[model samples]
Target: MVCIRCKMVLKDELTKLGLHYTVVELGEVEVVENISVQQHDQLKAGLLKWGLELMDDKKSVLIQKIKNVIVELVHYSEEPLTINFSEFLSSKLNHDYTYLSNLFSEVQGITIEKFIITHKIERVKELLVYNELNLTQIAALLHYSSVAHLSTQFKKTTGLTPSHFKQLKEKRRSMLDDV
Candidate 1:
């Protein structure tokens, strides 16, 4: 789960399955009762119907947690981080940065830094399409060193300058899950 709607769908499915959940945050859920095998299968099938998967493995759950943290930080949080992203991610996930990076790379076939860059660029594109924040403000909000850096990254990732991309008739932006 990566968005509110996903959470809603999960909650609805749990309710329909007669399960009581204490919490249903992004990428995690805590049920009040121990799930039976039948309930588990039903829940999995329900989630799959909505294009969601119930991850049972430790590695897949960890990867989803990493993604949820990044998605929350990039798309939802308004406050800036006091520490750098690597340290922050390590601390948040309670694992060494090297281990997290290696596992993420080995499983996802991309480095964690690359994942962050891709998400950041996608956020920048969303902000540009909104047309509310200027380039400088967008850069500051996204924690870029400067507008020049943001512009360079935007252009490099999309093969189009921010201004050019914004001025086009079709404003192309990717879905957060797809990013």
Candidate 2:
């Protein structure tokens, strides 16, 4: 689950199954009862109908958590990331940075840094399309050192400079899920 609608659907499905949930945050749910195997299977099947999966594997869950944290930081939050990303991830997920990086790369076939850059670029595309903040403001918002740095990364990722991208009629910006 990556969005609010996803969470709402999951909550509805859980209620239909008579399971009481205390929380239904992105990528994780805390149910109040000890669900039976049949209930678990029912919940999984229900979620599948909504194009969601019930994750049981620890590593997969951890990977999802990593993705969730990045999504929250890039798309949802306004606060700047004060700490180094490695330290932030390590502290948040309670795992060594090396272990998390290795596991993320092994499981997702992309390094964590690459994943972050991809999302950041996507967010840049979003902000540019919005036209509310100029390139300088966007650079500061995304923690880039300067508009030049953002422009370089943007061009490298999308084959179009940020100004050119905004000027285009189509203004192609991918959805967060697509990223």
User: Root-mean-square deviation of each candidate, in angstroms?
Assistant: 5.0, 4.8
TM-scores of all predicted structures: 0.92, 0.92
Per-residue error (Å), model 2, residue 82: 1.9
Provide the global lDDT of candidate 2 against the true structure. 0.91
Q: Show model 2 residue runs off by greater than 4 Å.
A: 170-179
Model 1 regions more than 4 Å off: 170-179
Candidate 1 clash figure, as a count: 0
Write model 1 residue lDDT over 17-102, tens digit each, in one string: 89999999989999999999999999999999999999999999999999989989999887999999889999998999899888
Estimate every model's Cα lDDT from 0 to 1: 0.90, 0.91
Clashing pairs in 1: none
TM-score of predicted structure 1: 0.92
Q: Tell me the RMSD of model 2 versus the true structure.
A: 4.8
